[model samples]
Target: MRCDNGPELISAALGEWCEVQVIVLHWIQLGKPTQNAYVERFNGSFRRKVLNAYLFATLRQVRHLLTE
Candidate 1:
C-alpha cells in the first residue's frame, strides 16, 4: 500500500498488521500530494459530497446513506 506519513498510518499496530499480512507499505515524500493524486481526489470529493452535505445523528444513519 502506498500512503503518506499520517499518524494513523504510522501506528505500530498498523505496521505490525501489514508486516504479518506481507503487504509492503511505500511512503511518499512529505508534502508531495501528487504522488497520491487519485486517492486525494477521491477524498476531496467524498468530503464535499457526503461528509459536508449531511449531519448524521448516528453511525447507522451514515452507513445507511452510504448503502444508498
Candidate 2:
C-alpha cells in the first residue's frame, strides 16, 4: 500500500505487523503527492461527491447514503 509519511503509519506496531505479513508498505516522499496521483484523485472525487454534497447528521446517515 502506498501512503504518505505519517507518524502513526510509521509506528513500530504497524511496522512489525507489516513485516510479519510480508506486506510492502511503500511510502511517498514528503511534499511529493504527485507520486500518488491516482489515490489523490479518488480522494478528491469522494470528498466532492459524498462529503461536499451533504450535511451528515450521523455516521449511520452517511452509511445509508453511500449504500443507496
Candidate 3:
C-alpha cells in the first residue's frame, strides 16, 4: 500500500486489504524528485485534477478540497 499521508480516508484504511506494506513519504524527503517518479506524478495529478477544478469561494472550500 503506497499513498501520500495527505488523505486520511485512504491512509486510515491501509493494510486492511490483504497483507501489504505501507510507505508514506515525507514532503521534504519527496522534494528530492527522484525517490519515486510515478508516485510524484500522481501527486501532481491529484493537485491538478481535484485542486484545479474548483474555484475556491472561501477558505473553507480550499480546506475541504485538501481534506478530500
TM-score, per-candidate, Cα-based: 0.85, 0.67, 0.34
Worst 10-residue lDDT window, candidate 2: 1-10
Best by lDDT: 1
Give lDDT: candidate 2, residue 16: 89
In candidate 3, what are the lDDT values of residues 1-68, reduced to their tens digit? 33443455344355453234445434424345555568779878988887677788799988887788
Instruction: Candidate 1: count the clashes.
Output: 0
Off by over 4 Å in 2: 6-22
RMSD of 1: 1.3
Can you write out model 1's per-residue Cα lDDT over 10-68, one digit (the tens) per residue? 99998999999999999999999899999889989999999999999999999999999
CA RMSD for every model? Answer: 1.3, 2.6, 7.9
TM-score of 3: 0.34
Backbone clashes in model 1, listed as residue pairs: none
* C-alpha lDDT of residue 41 in model 2: 93
The clash number for model 3 is 0
lDDT of each: 0.94, 0.89, 0.59
Better lDDT candidate (1, 3): 1
Give the C-alpha miss distance for residue 57 in model 2, angstroms.
2.2
